[model samples]
Target: MSVEPLQRSAVAKDEQWNLQHIYATAKQWEDDYRRAGSLIDQVAGYKDRIDSASALLAFLEQEEELGFLYEKLFVYASLKLDEDTRVTEHQARVDRARSLGVKISSATSFFRPYLLSLDKQTLDGYIAQEQGLEYFKKELYDQFKYKPHVLSKDKEEVLSQLGEVISAPKTIFGMINNADIQFGEVTNEQGEKVALTRGMYMRILEGRDRERRREAFKAYYKPYVGLKNTIASTLAASVKNNVLFSRMRGYDSPLHRSLFADDVPVSLYDNLLQTTREHIAPLHRYMAYRKQKLNVDELRLYDLSVPLVDDCEVSIPYEQAYETMLAGLAPLGGEYLDILRKAKTAGWIDVREKQGKRSGAYCWGPYGTHPYVLLNYNDTLDSMFTLAHEMGHALHSYLSDANQPRISAQYKIFVAEVASTVNETLLIRHLLKETTDEPFRRYLLNHFIDTIKGTFFSQVMFAEFEKLVHERAMNGEALTADAFSEIYEALFTAYNGELVALDPEVKYGWSRIPHFYNAFYVYKYATGIASAVSIAGRILEGDEETTKAYMTFLKSGGSEPPLELLRGVGVDLLKPEPIRDLLSLFDDLVRQLEEL
Candidate 1:
């Protein structure tokens, strides 16, 4: 069966978000590029001319204004580039942004070193002389706080130059995964052969044919395993880069450096993995129950995605999904729902899979334009949930961009996952309550359980694996492919706890996770989901105060620290309640599945 191209006429030309939205056309972007380059030379005037307090304040304000203008142009170009990465023109625009960013970064690089050079009394006197300087006091302090980590300006510049090449390993991995590697065909039980690729892997993995799923898993990982050494080298280089940078910058460890960038406490990340490890019994018990419920003699990796209860397919069309999403989020009040309805009517979504299109989904936009979401819309229950999830991000960006300054508009990745998972949490609650059929309810309950297991426990396991590998490399231990495999195998065995067979093939799991290159990122997915469960439960329970606080958190953007933002939403993520509540939800879902 061939997948048909999505109808683009159904949506506005601008809704598709071609590069024209960034500028009316490519030529305009080029012209702006030249204008921006000229402005870069002007920024040099502020470099070393801040002797007086008034001069310093004027220079700082002017520098920020220039930065905002440059960012507006850069974001537009970069967002356009992400849409169709292969397009030469869009790539040119993206290259322009990167080049300009580096140039501007170099130009402004003196600000931090210069500030750090000032003595405490001199800095305090300057701060007092110009009260307006207080707005940037925190920003200045952040830069100086890393003085122990900051190298000489010349060395830092050399490191900055090395940054682009340092990304090659991960970029190579992405190219191999997205553009080059292909999965071989696996035959179904019906004697039909289906070609396997990353796109089709999920659908195949979810098939009723256990043998086909097994073959699919093997075929998918075979290439990865063959190239394990190369992958290991790339990963080692990336992790080594992190360790080197952290140690150079005066951090105790790479993990500390990574978390410090996002202003997150390292303990929060450590606790997420530790708590998840402690609760492995629940995950194991759920997996055991799933094996029996599905009546499989052996539960393999492929069996993880299959629905426990059949005959209860929740096939939702794009429109119905939109309505359900609107209704599901009505607790957000009329204004929020109206914005959603407008998104639906205004063609904010590109709602079908098309030829030569990107796999997966995302939300993208520049400042002036509202956010646009792209989805393949396969009509599965998970697809609907994804629609709800991406919309959560789009709406968050919309609200934050609307209310905050450009510098503060973009939230950190630490807090970025919360809005999307909160949307998922609300959508699940709505469906569980809206349905009356017992079997369907049971299936939905099972689905919710899988969400918790996959998001919280599985990601936390990955985080543990990531932490171990980094620690090993930091300790002068080699990160050979076999060593990596052994570490992951240990984690899998420990977390699985005999629920299912840990296939020897599963040892190559480290080759497949891209987040390891990202450094200390996967744990946030677990922590974010836990935090969302708390926030969503409160809103679902008609806690008006919590709802208001959550809305405030969304609008607050990066104005405060990530923890402060989350705390405002009534989720004490520092405490253990959110994690315990998440585990309780998983336990309840398991009990429901048992009854079913």
Candidate 2:
């Protein structure tokens, strides 16, 4: 079938997401769901056998089969959920997966607690006893890293059962953000009114008219401010969840627990925030230049996203954008490039905007299937950037799946953004160099500078806010909406001191950022972007060693901790060099824009 026909077939029902790709029909999905249900019963059979090394290994092999099936079922339901929030049937299917998740989790809870319960000698002996299970030794050894806090099986099962409830705060916040709350309309300076949707907010914020950007900022925040208390409570609840989990798991702090969940060190996160704080002067200086160029007397919060060069625009259709991105990423060589081309031809990308579709973009899929990307294409430079970002993730999954076992194919959240941001960095740098048109070059250069600012500096500022909120809550302080606003407002002043006017309403910025609900999540964006900038430079310089190491990082999957994974790829995030390099690049771009 032609691309047009396939596209129509995929989205024929106007469903939130296209699930037909997974099972071809709802009946097939039901059949798979029932198959998953049957597999749940078989898990109980393995419970008793888990104590014996030989029996446990056999059970693990059986469990992997179940896991593979469950992944398909789960991914199908999740993609459906992302496509449209209004699909009740898909919601029920998602709920089914969530509810069954507890069962599958409970069935496997004994594996870790039991392994840790065994003495190191016995565990090592078990590894020595069976060659078949030797490959899993690292997997077990990684679990034992949490040995100090490993709970008893019964307690672990209880935690597993409560997992859904434990994840409620994030779910509630997502529902509110994606399905419940709505921002009112804002009129641009030209008197053209636009609905202040989450997707359009950025477009308006980047408008040339200073007053329109300000109005958009206020109009966007208006609903969030009114609903501030509720959003604050939701965020507070999430923090409390992290705190409780950390305390219960014997971690030192919420941040430690969050980072430790994926084996990330606290030092890396701390270093990122501290380095960004020390370097805020550069960011502020850039912002000051932007204010002068935009000719705003007192640069307000709304003035932040506006481009200094107003008349320039970079617009490319989807196909041209793909080719441009492909050329930029050619350094990865034939194998990696071939995988991306397959992804493009395989209907792996859902690339157009439609009604009721979720805001933002993500690359998602389970094991045994190709990764899928969902994007709202707007034919702007930013839209092209989003495509690059999501494709980075899709390609990472593609490489990991092809290279690693299903058991370890999924990459952790910590290293997840590295791949995506690396693509964006490469794509932006290529655009800057390839396009000689002065106006477009300036626009691309300014856009690159803005990305570094937004993704690296601004996220670090937000991460600081995350750190403060968690620490404050730990110290017997309540995170009321007002209190949050106060803390975040002061942070804004510190972060953008001389650059822009930190409006009081900007205090509620914390309420608008969804990452805060995920606890210590936003920092990764900063660190990831920094690492990407560093890595992209190496690849562009045709450093074969760096390019090979970076591809190895992509293929490493969840086999190693995020820090070690990146370290293996030659970027030591503990030192502040990567971030400094990013800021320096931003400085260069700033000069280039000035020269233009």
Candidate 3:
């Protein structure tokens, strides 16, 4: 049943994350906000003086300082706003921080163009002349990779200043999804009408009561279906805006524009989509298996999430869940375990979901501070896995921050999910190995299947959807709610198989995803899992050499190109073997399920 969320003050102090470590009070946050604004104003001081190696070194140093301050300030504002999205005060802070960020971008837009203006020989000479440049050498040399995409200084400045405008679509959607939209209500267990929520929807969808699941399916989509047009507009604006930027940057497509940052090619994106579709038979078989196991004559989209082994739901209290997570992840050794323990006890994690808080879980932190995780924890098995997943990100961040310079500590999104996925893989494997119950063992196996489906199959389907919408927008086709539904439904049927029935709400799946606003990002989840499957397997087999290499990979951070970094740990995305291996295991698991 959906009860009103507790007020922020109602929650115990320790249950909430310690924002005090970032800033003691709102007053201090404002002070840093102002400090960042002042620094943004002075960013123009390094204008033409960056031509010389010594001057460039000085400019880089100042830029790094400003970056450190801006990141911390922005993170605070964003996290504070997430705590209570309805609060206009936090919203104002986020707005001011974003505006200051735009100013910084606009002011420093000249540096890249100037740096690219010099010949490689001259740039190398400058790097050699300045000993301090060693720290920034990789970042500096990496600028040449973007020589083709770098716009003129004037153009770049104008574009940089429009950061707020460019982000408007995402910002509007955030408000709609988090604060404004409501998921109507569903019938509770007692047959009393109760308000529905995202957390409730997740649990109910997986519930054994088919009617409750059906009721929730409609209630959950009630808002999105009702406001389809508005969400469609926001999403369209985001896609078209990406198209505009991609064209302006002279990239082949928006996909290329996004992958360009990590030095990935369009082929990798296309390969993920194609390969997943080709190997989608096992997913179809799993759906059929679900239909058989659940004894439902016709499987519906809502039926997809309910565990095949029904009546296996287990409640894991937060403390119990945390302890279980620690036990599951103990394979990573003591150092990792020590940090994980500290994260739970320290103010690093916001554990419970309350009113107006952000709905999802993620790990984030500013440099020189421990990483923070925001979880709308519902104390379910899924919630426990989420804990493991997000903490994976935290451990990665902690290692990177401690080992690398600030510039490299921020790893790219491509390699970012690997650490998180590895933790999840190891955790699930540990649970499976330790569990003695046969049905729960099968339930765990089902959970792992869902992970592959969600993280790999579903993501690739989304990657394809993203590609199609962008291509449509690129071709000057009209983007509407109906148009999006048509494309989404067809893909849904194609990837999911027609053996299952479709719900009207299924097509509107594109509307609810916050990730679509950030273009071409989900494919990395598919790539990440493929890599993690390999890394986790090796580690599980007592491969110390691989474990050491994996830890080093986490510490390496953004020092090298993401692909090269993955290659060091034996995950080469350019090769299809890893993806193929993952898919083959998935096929084997389905056969095992068939036997069971």
Candidate 4:
């Protein structure tokens, strides 16, 4: 049945996340906003005395406290705006919060440059003398590591002042994609006119009706086709921004600059792309099986998302999904489960889709508060897994916040996906063990295969595309809509092989992906799932020591470098073994599905 999306007011209270946990009222939020602004000014007053140990310690403590309050205010306003983008007041609050954040950045711009002015030995002596400075030892050392990239105080201030303007491309892209682009209606299997949307378009693609799927795919890309030139310009500007920052910072490339932040080796990114390309046969085989199972004359891009076994239905309600996630994550022990239970009832999740709500799911929150998850959930096996995946992030945040100080509580994006993917892996493993039905078991196996294809294969494709575009821009090549489509088409052909028929519209698919605006971000998803596969395999096999190591890694948070943290957990991404093992797992699952 085709139905209109519900209004935000119509959603049940429990189904929505409680933002009052952050601030009970808008007036309270306004008060904190004022307080944060005052603190930013006070912190800036110590600019001349930043070299002193006592002054530095007091400034760091004040900045940390201000950061916590500012984050709470910013998250609440931004989240409320996302809940219903049509609200003007919410939009104003979001703007105010963002503007305040830029001001805060400008106010604190002196800290890094001033700290870099001091020699490492002097900074080390300060850390040893001042007990309070001990808390920010890693942070101070990190600034020293970036000494080469740190600009003069005046230049740094200018750059920091441009933060809001520098972020304009992504802001424009979000408005156009989320609020402006209109996908027209499509006739469904029931012969009713269904309004097509980004979310609805995905559901339509997963339908059994072939014509409807094709219709939705074409309809969804129609606006994108019309706005291709504009989107291309926006994306080009975004890429140019990345190149600009890389040059300004004296890095070899934008990729180098991005990886340098997290201490990830460039070789690791290359290894994933190379390793996945070598193992393309399994992906081709899976495509072949999908074509045969669907019995399509030609496997178009729309056909890729549909289920291989049509009768394998697994619909888990939210309550049941929560219970299943708890059981699946039992290997992490009782204390972890207790935290999950509290998060479940503590209004940490907003669990329904409605009109003008932002599409997709994410876990976000400030350092001092419990992590909040935003989900546009519809009951499906995929949604159940999403619950587990996001909870993985939530628990990770919970543990990190509880263990680390405010300064180091937030983990880097490189290792952030590991926790989330680990939960998904355990949930799938538990499902496979408990299911007795042969067809359903095969379906479970297929789900795992699809996850690899989507998370590992697809993200690597995006990573490669991002790398190519940025490199092209860096090398003085012109980037246009046609140029982007051509690059994307070639990569799609290489990855999909000759088995699947390519659609011309799929070439323009690059414009629709929001992640492109955030350069060098998608590759982490690939590395994350690979790490999870190795870690989950060990836990499922009763490796108690590995399990203990994994738990400790979760608690360590941003206290250590991302690669070093992963090494502590026994998953060394620097080696090719994890990627190879993940490919082997995919091959084994495909064979199992074939046998069933």
For this target, which candidate reaches the highest TM-score against the unseen true structure? 1
Q: How much is the lDDT of residue 403 in candidate 4?
A: 92
Runs off by more than 4 Å, candidate 3: 1-42, 73-110, 116-122, 152-204, 215-245, 311-323, 341-361, 374-380, 471-486, 503-508, 511-514
lDDT of 1: 0.80
Q: Which residue pairs collide in model 4, if any?
A: none
lDDT of 1 by residue, 214-286 (tens): 8999889988888899888888888898888888888988999988866777788777777767766778888
TM-score rank, highest first?
1, 4, 2, 3
Worst 10 residues of 4 by lDDT: 1-10
Each prediction's TM-score versus the true structure: 0.88, 0.85, 0.83, 0.86
Clashes of each: 1, 2, 0, 0
The clash number for model 1 is 1
Q: For residues 39-157, what per-residue lDDT tens digits would candidate 4 score against the true structure?
A: 99899898877767888899999998888888998899988988889999999999999999899898887777788888888988888889988788888888789988878778987
Spell out the clash pairs found in candidate 1: 149-249
Misplaced by over 4 Å in model 2 are 1-35, 76-103, 106-116, 151-200, 222-241, 311-315, 350-361, 374-380, 477-483
Which pairs clash in the backbone of model 2? 16-83, 16-84
Q: Candidate 2 versus the native: TM-score?
A: 0.85
Candidate 2 residue lDDT tens string, 43-96:
667754666678768877767777887888888888887666677887898899
Q: Residue-wise lDDT of candidate 3 within 1-596, one digit each (tens)?
A: 12367888988777789988889898887787777777766668878777688898888888888899989899999999999999999999899889888889988877877888887899889889999998998898778778778788789878878989999999999999999988877898788899998889999988888989998999888899999999999999999999998899899989989888789989888777777777889888988888888898789988988878755568788899888888887767888899888888789999888889998899999999889999877767888889999999999999999999898888988888899999888888888889888888888788788889888899888999999999999999999999999999999999989888988799999899999999888888899999998888888888888888898998888988988888888777886778888998788777866776
